[model samples]
Target: MGQKSLVSTWHYLVALAAFLLSYFAGLPMPWIIVGVIAVGLLRYAILSKTSKIDAIPGPLVIVLAYVGFMAGFNHFHQSYSMAAIGLITTAYFTFLPNFALIFVGAPLIERTQKNTCIQFILSLVTASVVGVIVNLACYLGIGILFPSGVSSWYAIEPMALVWVLFSLFLLFKYKIGMLKLILLSLAYGFLLFLWRLNKMPMG
Candidate 1:
């Protein structure tokens, strides 16, 4: 299969996994609906003919950024308005391969274009600046509503730590060609769903 096709397949599989596992997890229906819409939008953004980067799909970027963002919020009490979260997420995914490629490297994308390496650097800088600006604006306008407290996902579910680390490992190692990332993430998501389901009261 072609590179774009492969990337799309990966995203489709993962998105489906996330949707189903999230439903089984007993997440609020609204949250699952929004998540599906977000994935659909990311899929459209990355797959559109006008997309700049070929190898790195938008949903991968979203997942990496989201994991990092939630990790911070859950651990450090780093609270921000939903607007700021949306802006940050939008900026990272819109720019394509922002932080994910920074940590993972872009061997596949680099092979596709003559100047993408430079473009990658510039895009990273731009995304960072935009993220900071929007975050500041949100803080100044609405203020960061600090929560009373929040449990870290890893603490609440120790397996989450393993799941995240393993996901990042495969992503960094470029094992995605084997669909290891999708499969492993789906496995982890399913396990997470079961964990959450078990915690819910018997109806």
Candidate 2:
């Protein structure tokens, strides 16, 4: 296989492992599977040169989504640390090919070298901070405002917050169309509903 193929394979492996760890660490099976599939598809899209937007990497998405998921559900438990490790791993992968490309220039390769460890670490930290702050603010703010009531429906799931924040960021930063953003937000809600279908009556 070519170097790029190798790197993509490695990304898939690591992403899968981290997601499995997250499942063991308390993330539900359905969410873990969805997370892995989403990241895998994003990787495939990037490698295939079919992705129109490169500003949102799967690792960053995972971090942001997970933060929102935690906040919305308040599901912290004994496996928090393990789940956190999985999140960190996902974030670390965000630095591969350098985060500089996220803002400008060509798409980055799915690979990072030892010489750029400092840059990788810094990017990981930065993305983690951004993810936490953005997701927490949206989820917690909605939670506080609604508290309890039919209005609280908006604050009940991480899916809406996750996709909304990411979609809005992409819409503004990269200028993806507003229609796409609306579709994504709707999709996120549907995705959440499907995931909960098994646990809730009529989902």
Candidate 3:
């Protein structure tokens, strides 16, 4: 591991660059997407004769840990108790599926590493899956912290239950087009917000 680490020193540099670019771009959770694209470009398009992107040692994890910290603070720090962060983060077991998807996607990526455009496509998919994972964690964390309000919808509404089940099936069983799924979630979140606003009695 140590020997391999020395040769892959450029990995974190690319990661840092990705984070800065994400910050400037104002994209939510941009680090993973940027890092993935950078590594792909380096391996397939830029340095194809010299190196491969797989050497980057999964830079997504750096973004993952950063997101976790923010999740810890946003979800837990402002809650009834700070200690709930540990329990909520732990109880959700949200990272399990994300890590599982990463492992599952690893072997599949070998088939497309040689193509420049295809590599970025794969990177986008990877970032999308990570986004879903992190979103799931935060979602479950909210429920854990506020059970009555956050988790009760599924029980009262059959459509909600069906949608939740279908979403899980799509995310875990199916492996392609994750970016679409992320967009779907974003749209759903917006509609949910609007629905809540509509419920408010205005003066």
The per-prediction CA RMSD against the true structure, in angstroms, equals 18.2, 16.8, 17.4
| Candidate number of the best TM-score | 3
lDDT of 1 by residue, 59-154 (tens): 534543443344234333445553355336434442443344434555654654568676788567566646644543333222112122134432
Pick the winner on lDDT between candidates 1 and 3: 3
- The TM-score of predicted model 1 comes to 0.27
**lDDT tens digits by residue: candidate 2, 1-203:** 45466346545654543443321322222233333333353333222111111113234456434533332222234355644654454456434323443434322323443448856785775665466446544433454334353354554545445665687689789998867766775676578668888677762
Structural RMSD, model 1:
18.2
In terms of lDDT, which candidate is stronger, 1 or 2?
2
lDDT of each: 0.42, 0.44, 0.45
TM-score of each: 0.27, 0.24, 0.29
Query: lDDT by residue for model 3 over 37-138, one digit each (tens)?
Result: 333423322222112222222244444343333323343434434334423432233345445555676676576679899877857866765775465455
Error of 2 at 64 (Å): 36
Model 3 lDDT at residue 15: 41
For residue 187, model 2's alpha carbon misses the true position, in angstroms, by 1.8
Query: Candidate 2: lDDT of 11?
Result: 55
Off by more than 4 A, model 3: 1-146, 149-160, 172-174
User: Which window of ten consecutive residues has the lowest lDDT sum in model 3?
Assistant: 48-57
